[model samples]
Target: MSVPTVDLLALCTTIKAWGRELGFAELRITDVDLQHAESGLQAWLDAGHHGQMDYMAAHGLKRARPNELVPGTLRVISARMDYLPRDTATDWRARETARLADPAAAVISVYARGRDYHKVLRARLQQLADRIAAEIGEFGYRVFTDSAPVMEVELGNRAGLGWRGKHTLLLSREAGSMFFLGELFIDLPLPVDAPVSTHCGACTACIDICPTQAILGPYRLDARRCISYLTIELKGSIPLELRALIGNRIYGCDDCQTVCPWNKFAQRAVLPDFDARHGLGSADLVTLFGWTEAQFDQIMAGSPIRRIGHERWLRNVAVGLGNALRAAPSEALVAALQTRIDHPSALVREHVLWALAEATERS
Candidate 1:
């Protein structure tokens, strides 16, 4: 039995509609020729800008060649979902600024406080692809969300969803940059979207505001020195020199994104899955430090924070505590450091001891 081929234009239209129905903010498609992007990617890798994330180098040119990584891929459908928390009080950048100064405050990146975006985006993208498959009758496809080896930002830009910002994140006039990106690679040859013009003209807010100077140039990031990369992606002991610059950002940092003037236009997520849970958006360092391993698991389940596990969580919290101690050394801070003095994980205890010494020095 032959499955009649579906019209490519019709399929693209249907996929876009289905994506909207499934809660994606925008959907765009592009052909798989990333020749223009290859040089930038090669340069980034050659400079070791990826830090300890060797997979970026290991994938080599395959990162830019979608069809090579996913055989028979002809079109890539890129989708964006806005993730700003709704019904917030004052500006988030102001809050993050306060957290940086307080030291006793725990600052998790705004994106990681809610449910894991990987799970949220993958499920929605799969459902969108499944709906297309039902109509087209068994098309070859693969869905990806923050998955390895896919040049997602490049694909999103090529698909006309947005242009890559100076910080290397995809940004749109309509969507700003507070969003998650996902991809659906299909064998069907869909019409490609035209790229949009760059709007980050002469804007160095993200570059200048980065505490670690991670944004080396316009659209170039040295992930090795990025706080987000240092705290979350770099699995080993964080380099001692970078620890103080990390400030109170325990899990991930949002300094660059928070300072972007374009982010004022950032949209709130339509899906409830992204709403902040466990009061994480406003949690204090001491409160989070008081959590037992079981409490940590219970509180962080379904959140991206779970991936770092308890040891790293404590290690991060210790850094925040250390900063807090320096900012306002107190008996409470001393007790917290002492409680974790003999923590089971050497990594946790090491950071705690360093934090205690820092607190003592401040006193």
Candidate 2:
């Protein structure tokens, strides 16, 4: 179907205005070409950096060629939402570092502290699309948020959202790396924005602070060793070598971001949706580990953490508990882990046994 005729420049202006109204912190349009990122992606996959995310390799070059992946994808309307929770303290980075030192604290990635962003982004993007449709009648477009094979970060960079930081995350000088990215592939030929110059000169703070050395080099991340991928993506035994380095981060790791100089400028969410929920921002390992399977489901029903399921939940908390034992051994910590000693999933049981042993060794 032919795309409805619209004044392209005026439309771009309206789209950006609509995006801000929809709570997106920033939005820009880019053509559907991602040839620049294709080779780097292929090399990362070849090096097995994607770990068990076979889908990264399975998609082939189709991922870079959005025009082919989704026919009639003339322009990608990229959007970034600042995800630092609304109530985040001004000294949030130092506060997070303090959490890491508190052995009993349960550190979830800031992004997952609230409602699942996949749902939030898709709904908001669809609203933007609907508003556009209202302005120009029927149109061809599909909204995506961390969905499928979309090269979201590349599109965001090309659209002038921000440069991909050395840690491989999109970083804005104004907003830092505390944000989520989404895309709208549309048939409209929107005027594209100019790409921004990278400002990560001679700064390896992100790489230097990585607990697992996941950042093999500037702009190259080995997901296999990344704590986030280990705790959330890998659905098997937590690799013993990296378990202790995982620290008390049970869901995702923000060490790289917290340490980045640019993140000092990270912006807070305009919408309250990204605010920390259920006191997850302040939860402790023993307290989190003590939740029963039913309690886990009930509390985590609308959370991104729920996607990891009860078994993985126990597994991650167990790793945290074990690390906590070495940091601050207590009868309370050991007893909390003991309650899950006979968990039905061997994954959970083994981690619990390991946690118990960690406490015993400390004693």
Candidate 3:
């Protein structure tokens, strides 16, 4: 079961080359030792910073112990894929900021605007695995994007893909934080890469710009207060205290990344799969809230936003529409909220009522 030293080195080199051909921006290998991250993870969990993501606590230390998760795993191949749409304008940051200021805009995070990264990265990673099998004989391996108990950022950090930024995202000097990470947990003992030095310096831009101040400090995030978690992860009531801070963001929040200076170098996707679909990049809250449940399912068929299901989608849009009504008293926004005020899902009904009240209070 042992590979020759020279052959292992050659295989590692070839694997990286194949990864590039498959659209990964960069690929590096790392050993399965995440012992250094275990304490921080435990402390975060103990503080309940993971919010309602019970799955984060479900796997316990197996998240850091890759070998335990997949027995016989020796090395993990961490791959990065930049997700900025290929047609991204040079002033995309300024444009995003403007969208946030426009109360009527529905600011879906840049990442979720296209096809689901889980599907895109998982398929590409599996294809890379298949290629590895074709190169070597049958190899034991499992591929993962964000769908498992794996600590992807830590793995990517250890693999020399990037250092962990203050926002807790893996950041590269070349590609920044606007990228998706996937991994290949394989039995191959490929030569491990060196970890990169941290480059965040004294920058606190990400923390300062968070709408919900979810970041407690550098590298410490309270997911319970995070706008992304509130909209995408939290399943119950949107915390009343934080709803106003949610602004018009209907999906994941990107304030942290948008403000990071490193993202000035964020790369664009080589694959068309990451391109914006259905005018999501420029959509208004009123327009998005007007979509029928059937229309939402059909339009969001291949997108990651669909996973939230139509109920939560409506709930998020209701919050956005409410925020818009408070900011500008838009009749269109109020009318949209009324259409769903009687929706069957109580979650949708509650949010719609709150949205209507937001406008009424302004009167």
What C-alpha lDDT do the candidate models reach, one value each? 0.87, 0.91, 0.93
Q: On residues 273-340, what C-alpha lDDT tens digit does candidate 1 reach at each position?
A: 88899988788888889899999998888999998888888888888888778778889988978999
C-alpha TM-scores of all predictions: 0.96, 0.98, 0.98
Candidate number of the best lDDT: 3
Q: What RMSD does each model have against the real structure?
A: 1.7, 0.9, 1.1
lDDT of 3: 0.93
Q: Which parts of model 2 are misplaced by more than 4 Å? A: none
lDDT of 2 by residue, 174-252 (tens): 9999999999999888889999999999999999999999999999999999999998899999888899899999999
Model 3, 1-363: lDDT tens per residue? 555334888888898899999999999999999999999999999999998999999999999999999999999999999999999999999999999999989999999999999999999999999988877778889999999999999999999999999999999999989999999999988889999999999999999999898999999999999988998899999999999999999999999999999999999999999999999999988888888889999999999999898899999999999989999997788888889988999999999999999999989
At residue 210, candidate 1 shows an lDDT of 95
Candidate 2, 278: how far from true, in Å? 0.6
